[model samples]
Target: MLLRLLLLICAPLCEPTELFLKPSPSQTIEGNSMTLTCEIQPRLQTSKAQLQFCFFKDNGALKSGWNSSPELRILAMWTKDSGSYWCEAKTAKATTTIRSRRLWIQVQRVPVSDVSLETQPPGGHVTEGKKLVLVCSVAKGTGNITFLWYKGAMGLKLGTKTKHALTAEFEILTARENDTEQYYCAANNGFGLSLSGLVSITVRIPVSRPVLTLRTTGAQAVVGDMVELHCEAQRGSPPVLYQFYLKDVTLGSSWASSTGGASFNLSLTAERSGNYSCEASNGLEAQHSEAVPLIITVPTENRRDLLTSGVIEGLLGILGPTTFVLLFCYCLKRKIGRRSARESLRSTSSPLPQDSTYLNSPTPVPLQPVYGNVNTLSGDDIYSLVYSTQLEQESPAEPPRTLSKDKVSLPIYSKLKKITVIDMDYDDAV
Candidate 1:
């Protein structure tokens, strides 16, 4: 009974030691070694006493019965190794036992990935003075992400956004000339960073009011001349198509891929003279220019044919009068020939012709004009009488037996440049 009382009293006399665990680094990379140290408070160096250490993780024992030195070393660490740890300190004499507060360790991992960029409206094209929405995203990634947008190489940073979502977007309130270029984005997490591929952007501009121009080498436009109809805009996108029209009819079309202007070549003709207009389009809205006059003047070379025709007409006018004069002279010659023949027939029938004074006397029969005009006898009538039987009976050999001086015949003749005129006088029988 005295030994039990002594043991109870001594059990209360031994002091309990404090224990703690210390990790070399609070955080470590995966596949890397980490050291954990178990230490006792008020370190004991006396030779009379023996002590042991134990390590624990997440309320479970990891290592036990460490002798002399109070330390536990880990070779490598993985994701599962992350947890709360502590250490236990005790005396070998079964006198006291103690534990330490928990120590928390964290592992870092993951980086941004699959960075890309796109635009709204889906056409990959847009008009000037319009809005453009740029959409950026990541196909796969973890942790908080920071997205940054940039223009072409060595370009300005458009904007940035910080979020945990897999996607983000930014809108360009109004697109400007500088907006037409290549663009890209970057996704960054604390672990790493990734850059996206380049995306091309085409900003369409409405063709400004077109200006129609006529290009020619002559001071005055004329037929058969080489003419060029050019259409251009003050500011517009390339690959523009230009159409030329004359009097609202399409003349030709041309295209320009590198500039804001296009032109059409044409061989001018008199029939092509009229108002001309031009239109410009770049796969957007078409812009038309005001009509400009293109009056074709007459060329001096074409007037040769007209002058030749006038000369031929003058020659015909002169020939028409000469033909009429020749016809009159021919008729006179025939009348004089008929008169000479009748006079010869009279001289043959009569042995002695009477004095020619009767040729100058008034005729016994009064002559009256007939055929076409009642005033005078026409040339045709005289020619018909010469071929008819009336002339044969009238000039018969037995008509007048007495050779009266008053009934004698008279003949007058004159020579012209190319013709002869004659006058025959005959009196009516009384």
Candidate 2:
């Protein structure tokens, strides 16, 4: 009996006996209302129990007020009503209980057939022979959706599909310039139809290789000669402007006729002799011509004649006296050289006779009359002595020495003898 009493008391006090409501894991949105219903389960007798319900968010915040009603009403549901929600209940026995099951609310927007279009390799223009991809997609919708692609003003459909989103690709493996067009996309469901914004794509064709032909009025251009250069592109489009360049600098420009050719006239000076090239450009593209060198040769003789008759003549007039002075100096140098040569010969081979007036008389006179003994004699003394000897021989006062022919040679031989005599008296005095 005591054991049964202890069991009854212990059971009621053991981990508060609870009863609560369990909501379904998912709830859907339809029309303007959303209903959230919960199922109640009790661990004890709920017949006598009064239950109160409370709703809580997944973040542990209370979302609705406490009540006994199992269903919560959301009027005019929107995307903000979508979240995790749960219920709590308290019994009259003071036994409180919490439900473990979670609810996920989802608000479904009305389906629409409106679609938007996008393209890859995005640009307003593309090159010829290039591949293009166009994608069309509905922003919000349910059920099957259809898509269509059109090109140009005629609204010709290039492709079609039956899906919520569709993608189409167009390839012109070898596209020409004429392949330019406007494009758009369309989407349709059983409910409604929608069209995408229009787009324009232009396919560009590359410029052709330019043919450069040099045109000149004359075969040869002389320096300081005026000439014209004509560059033509026979296959190109026009209002084409031709730019004439020498060594890559724009010298001048000319406008071509509708035939796509142009000419520029330039005076051929010395500075214009180099690689000459031209470029032709429309608004689309520009092409350069192959370099053609223009060589201008001027005759040296003609230039020299012009120089001499012009500025050079005036220059020569001012410098003529200086030139003459230089020539006169050169002639004087030649005359001085000849005079020096003659002086050298006279000094070496025939010496000038000494002036006798500057000579001292011989010491103590000669002791004996030594013929050819005269050592001190001026030029005048020698001349006078020689004249006196010649006069004495011519005079009739003295007879000439007579001897045989063999003897006659003796006096001449004696006169020719060079005698070196020493005087003892002059030596002793020294």
Candidate 3:
């Protein structure tokens, strides 16, 4: 049984087949060393196979190792030293030497340059509510590098990226004032590390919408009174500039410092009416306050200085109707006097005019009639003139009667009752 076990173990070593070279480390950093050893694939643990080892780099640069030593060491590796390295093993019992399979070694370059961080907004300063992008890049390096971004002195890791590319980016959505701090980035390859200079981020906050208040003891603004416009913003980073506006016209401006607000003053006038507003700015775009509607009126002390509009309007109401009635009565009296004179002339000699149109015409009285007994006629003659018509073409009716006292009585028109305005209190007597 022992002889059988020996044959099983030694039988593989009796015939040699293939040899391969293996390196201690397949990948190494720059300026480091690695070792390659040549071995037989099928070997007995106790069998003696004498071999001469030779190491070749990229099929050139031969290195001879004695049978005593089958290993070769390459020191101070560089970029040029990266290639296939293999070994040849020649056994003392074999007639020809056999070459081993190739093995490859990689030499990596460490970064020896600085890193820089640039902001997207060009200047590191950024406006609030805007996106902030930090770009980290290396000036010179070769290898897979890891980039890390730190915020402030706390070295808080904002983000990290590992890639073969020389540049990486980190982003912050909706930047705030608290985000303003010293920022930096680092590039780390396996061999060495590089840190960039400090980059500062400044977050600028714009002024808020201003609230405007009018400072006055009374509800209204009087002419020549100094009225103050107080403008305030709930939140902002200042020195902030403030302006007051009346109907889009600028009154004046004021300034506030360090998270505060501002104000403006104006001398009130009648022309200063309609819409009023205020504006707030912090070297940024201007923000305007909501408009407040204002209507200014004139102030008068006594009734004589100029009667109050209410009292003047009441006087006109009473006088207007009275004047109208008096004019109506005067016109009626003139019409009656003319008719009386015309009738008196017809009864004495000249007959009344036959043309109905002539009696109703609006033309002025003839110049001759003004002197011809117009004043001498009595009032009774006017009444007969309206009803008089000699029955030249009368229907079957009562014949015309002679003028009598009762038939010619004067017709009296009821005069518009004289409108009398009394000064009485219409309000409650109390």
Candidate 4:
């Protein structure tokens, strides 16, 4: 019974517990060496044990096994070397022990050398005879590289170099309309060939020699007349914008050819009677035509009417003051003449005049008709003269004789009574 108890304790103590590998989670590149070691727990002297190292993939397939060694060595590892492995040992008591741990291997790969190409001033209708440059660059890779340029299907070998960057320049001298096509590039580093994106190029042809033609809607332009002046380039490409000018000032503008030429018109005015010109441009460049003088004449009859009206207005403005002065002077002269005539009438009709001593005095006088009659005065006329003389003496400067007698001879006074009735209608008319 004691022996059986000893055997049971010994067997339980001697059995293997767990197995593991050193560098437990290791990794390595392809075409490289890797080492896997098996280790047992409880400080077992594993050198005395018969060891077996076995490897398997996670998919339950056996890779390889060794029955005599605890260590596994992999030389020049490849993708197929990547698997889980374990170690087993057989002791002198014939008991077998297995490792619960697993081993893994990793492989590295080289980078690919692929490149792309691009061009500036990218697409169609580039200016003709202009220099164009293309750039080629590697999109992926880590080695010496060279670039090759190609036009359509033809390959143009550029220089080879260790640098991955390269540029190719092509000058199109005197480019024709037909020199346009698709272009591409390739990058190579002896390992492989990589192609870039395709680019299309078109060389633009400049417009032909422009010819400006001037045309008018009418035979002659008159002032204030609506006229159309057409400036056209007959041979230019279509859809060109044009601007019209008169004497350096812009009148208006119009658009025509999309590809090349245009026409602009203007309505004529008196101020537009100078050299007229037009300019055509198509976003790229502009050109101006020679000046064409357009004369706008005014008719002689209309000019004469304007001059006559000006003269009449000027005359009226100058004559207004002179006429006012003349009228005032004439009114004053009529008043003075009437006053003198009244004075003469009063003196001649005075009393004591015919055979009096006053007639023998030194003052010689001529006898004139008084009141239109040579008369010896009646008593009433004598009294009237004496009374007027008295009144004139009372007011010396403003005597009654100073009153105008001509006013009394006016048509207004003809209805009044007169001392002598003379048929003097003919004389008054004269």
Clashing pairs for predicted structure model 3, backbone only: none
Error of 1 at 297 (Å): 2.8
lDDT of 3 by residue, 213-330 (tens): 8786467776667777888888777788888888888888988886557667777776687788999988877899999876665676632434666677888899889989999999
Which runs of model 1 end up more than 4 angstroms from their true locations?
1-109, 299-430
Model 2 over residues 136-225: C-alpha lDDT tens digits? 777755445677888887898887778533333444355456657777887765556688888877665433445555555567878767
Those runs of model 2 whose alpha carbons end farther than 4 Å from true positions after fitting are 1-123, 129-131, 135-144, 161-175, 218-243, 253-263, 280-287, 296-430
Q: For residue 24, what is the lDDT in candidate 1? A: 79
Sort by lDDT, top down from the best: 1, 3, 2, 4
Top candidate (TM-score): 3
- For candidate 1, lDDT tens digit of each residue in 68-104? 5577778777657788988876667655667888998
Cα lDDT for residue 423, candidate 4: 23
lDDT of each: 0.70, 0.58, 0.70, 0.55
Candidate 1, residue 240: CA error in Å? 1.1
| Model 3 spans > 4 angstroms off | 1-84, 87-108, 217-220, 295-297, 301-430
Off by over 4 Å in 4: 1-115, 120-126, 142-146, 150-182, 190-193, 200-210, 223-227, 232-239, 297-430
> What are the per-residue Cα lDDT tens digits for candidate 4 across 263-362?
5655655557788778766555667888877788767886687689779889989998899999999999978876665555566632332211122233
**lDDT accuracy of residue 404 in candidate 3:** 38
Q: Of 1 and 2, which scores higher on lDDT?
A: 1
TM-score of the candidate numbered 1?
Answer: 0.46
Clash-forming residue pairs, model 2: 356-378
Worst 10 residues of 1 by lDDT: 383-392
